[model samples]
Target: MKKDNKLKLNLQAILTDLLIWIYILGCVSFLVNHWFEKIIQTNFVVIFGVAAGFISFILGLSIGRKIFLPTIKTEGKWYKTFWGWSVFLLLLITFIVGWNLVEVDLYKLFAKFQNAGGIMKGIFNPNMDIFMQCLAALAETIYLALLATAFAIPLAFFLSFFAARNLMPQTFLGNTVYIIVRTIATIFRSIEAIVWAIIFSVWVGIGPFAGMLALMIHSIASLTKLYSEQIENINPGPVEAIKATGANTIQTWIFAVVPQIISPFLAFTIYRWDINVRMATIVGFVGGGGIGLLLLQQQQMLRWQNVGIIIWMIAIVVWIMDMVSAKVRGKLQEM
Candidate 1:
């Protein structure tokens, strides 16, 4: 009989195994094809980059891991621990390389703000007319965020049921559905609200409608992730009891998971809406259409008082949201 060790070859499939390989292969081939032009760039990054230093530090861990790597004779705890570290190191290296390749300009980002010194001053100065105007726009932003949460809450609820391992149709079909929903959430979340707004603006014409849709999509994606995790963590007792009582899947979920998690879910939704309002400012910076749009315009026109009003408007809105969420969350926890 063959002796089977606990650590057999890892056969688990990643979400994008083939796609990852293809992209990695493509990048390598592309670099090789343009080697004459790319050699300097690649060498500079690999030889002197912080990412390279981090990579080397991690590569050095192999020496320690080798001693820990379980041989057929050594199925020790240290070996398993080292093995997990190796996987983490691999992921860290990948993230560093990808981040470096993005070529972010931290200096230029700061410089943009520095150029608006006068606008910054005006943002501090109080003005009644502009202040009232900003209030109206901010109200719109809040409304957009609230509406998005409303849509996302119900949508995410349904998706989470499909995503929950206990609540899924069956193991294989349930897992497949879970993955699909997870993928959709990931893709939507990956696309910034500004980008979504831009796409919608093109499709539906620019206004609060475009902004509302963008917030809605992003909110759904984000809330789904949280909702799924919460659903998965819920107690199985009520669910099992409900099932035993001949309750259908939907009924079981409603009676069991909903009762246990609704408070936390509502708290999270309120908190997310507050965050979305903050994000709405940035989204409007790129024509998502909120008080941020007015802020941008005022800064450009050097209307410092108007900028001041916008800042105050944002500050007030955010402060109110903070207090509201805190109060609601406290009450929910008590319940």
Candidate 2:
């Protein structure tokens, strides 16, 4: 029995390693193909990608075994181990690649400093004439964020229970529900609100309504993730006690889970509101309506003073929201 158990564990480890290698191979191959296809100008690009991926897989296996296998002693200096060297190499490679990809050049910044003088001067002397107009737009931005958060709260609250692994029943149906809810939330959350805003702008026309919808959808996904995680971290003591009383799943959640998560949920919701407020400005650049749209217009026309006014207003409003949300979340934590 002991031998058989050891064999089983070995098989499982091997299978897991194979799967990880396969994933790495696929990603490396795709990246190689994408970046070299045009330059290579031949079917050899595909072959090169495959070769690169194979080499990467072999190296990965070697490094993984050296770092993880029990044959390596843990008492030595970290830099003397394979793991430390691997990390150093990884970071060095990443920095080199990132620098090339972003085309970093410090010389141009200093050389072009004088070109921005007009813009800086205008920003320093903001046009107060458009103060009322910018204020109204800022108000609309605030309201848009507020409405999105308000509408998302109940839906997110409803879906989070289904997403929480510990809260779901240990049955096929329960597992299916958990997977489906989690998948939907992840898919939506992966998409930025600005992208959603672009889609909705085309669907519902360019206005605050479209922006509100975009923010609402994103908020629902974000809040569901936060709420589910909070539920998962709750004390098992309350849960077991509720189960001992012959309570059903719903009753268990209501009695054992809800109370513990309420304060954290409120705090998370307030944090989301603060996030939405900031996102609202970004979405507006894509015709989602708000001060960002106004800022975009002034920028395009090179009306730097007016743009400065809008920027200041947005900064002020964001700062105020940040302070208010912080205070509210602090109070909730105390509760």
Candidate 3:
């Protein structure tokens, strides 16, 4: 009885697929009979495209039906289902549409490689004359990241208490404040570092200060969410014990929560500094005044040698920070 049902389903699907292809062919024949000459003048590209599209559609439908449409009689639920296949087909169709809209041509990408290679070769011979200036710009970038992280860490620490759900009841006032703080942090985080830099640049006139402001605001939003989550997940025993000892809310937090989180908080702050250092370079492109500003200027002026030196410097700094941060985090975790 199960075999009979499975056979019937497969037969029905094949018949449905045959009819769809027949209908497509009929439409193509009708078009060809009327507009053969006009299509011929444009060459066979259009006809080939239509035919290839139909062939691909039929092929995809056949393959997808076999995989997604479950025919197996199982004792338990099957992973392959009709609805799952339908969603898969819908996503496939969307991808095809997007690919066409983008007009991605690989030929253009290949064509540019020669010129790109020639420019890259020039970068091998870096101009050492600008090394001092580049070093200063790189130093400024590091300073910006350091300043931003310092400013944001303290602010994030305070805001996290208000954001932690475990600390606050779901009462009207508590819930309202939680929602507002969470929403604002989300909104701030959604705005990219570069966009923030642009806004601050306009407000304060372009400099490292603008970059610092951008990184600081973004860090606050990110660290608040991170710290709040840590607070929420801390050991409940200590919190309860502290409260039982007649400790007030602030006292409970300081004695119980703060001790648990201090190590992780320090680790998180160091990681953020590492991230900010990288971001400072990028934000500088929008007149935020870091090494990126210098790099961008060199690139625009066609000074690939200078740009190469700056690139190497940035790479070295990032590598060193990554190593240092890993060591610091490891030590913190051990503690």
Among the numbered candidates, top TM-score falls to 2
Ranking by lDDT: 2, 3, 1
In order of appearance, the predictions have TM-scores of 0.71, 0.81, 0.76
lDDT of 3: 0.81
The sequence of per-residue lDDT tens digits that candidate 1 reaches over residues 1-335 is 12232222111121122233333344443445454444334443333433433343354433222333324243456446533455465466566555556756788788788677776667666667765677778888888777877888889877777766666766777779978988888999999888998898788876677788888899888888888788888888888898999988778877988998898888888888988888888777777777877888887887787778788878888998899988998998899
Which lDDT values do the candidates have, in the order given? 0.71, 0.82, 0.81
By summed lDDT, which 10 consecutive residues of candidate 2 come out lowest?
A: 60-69
In order, how many clashes per candidate?
2, 0, 0
> TM-score of the candidate numbered 1?
0.71
Report the C-alpha lDDT of model 3 over 1-335, residue by residue, as the tens digit. 98887777766655554443444444444445445633333334445544644454355544224443445332322235433454455456556545555777888888878878645865787788998999999999999999999999989999999899988878999998988888999899899999999999999989999999999999999999999999999999999999999999999999999999999999999999999999999999998898989988998998888888898899999999999999999999999
Extract clashing residue pairs from model 3. Answer: none
Report the candidate with higher TM-score, 1 versus 2. 2
Q: Give every collision pair in model 2.
A: none
lDDT of 2 by residue, 1-335 (tens): 97786666545544444444444444444446557853433345445544543454345433444433445345566587644564565566556556656878999888989998878978899999999999888888889999999999999999999999998888999999999999999999999999999999999998888889999999999999999999999999989999999999789889999999999999999999899989999999998898878888899999989988888888888899899999999999999
Candidate 2: RMSD over Cα atoms?
4.8
Question: How far off is residue 175 in model 2, in Å?
Answer: 0.8
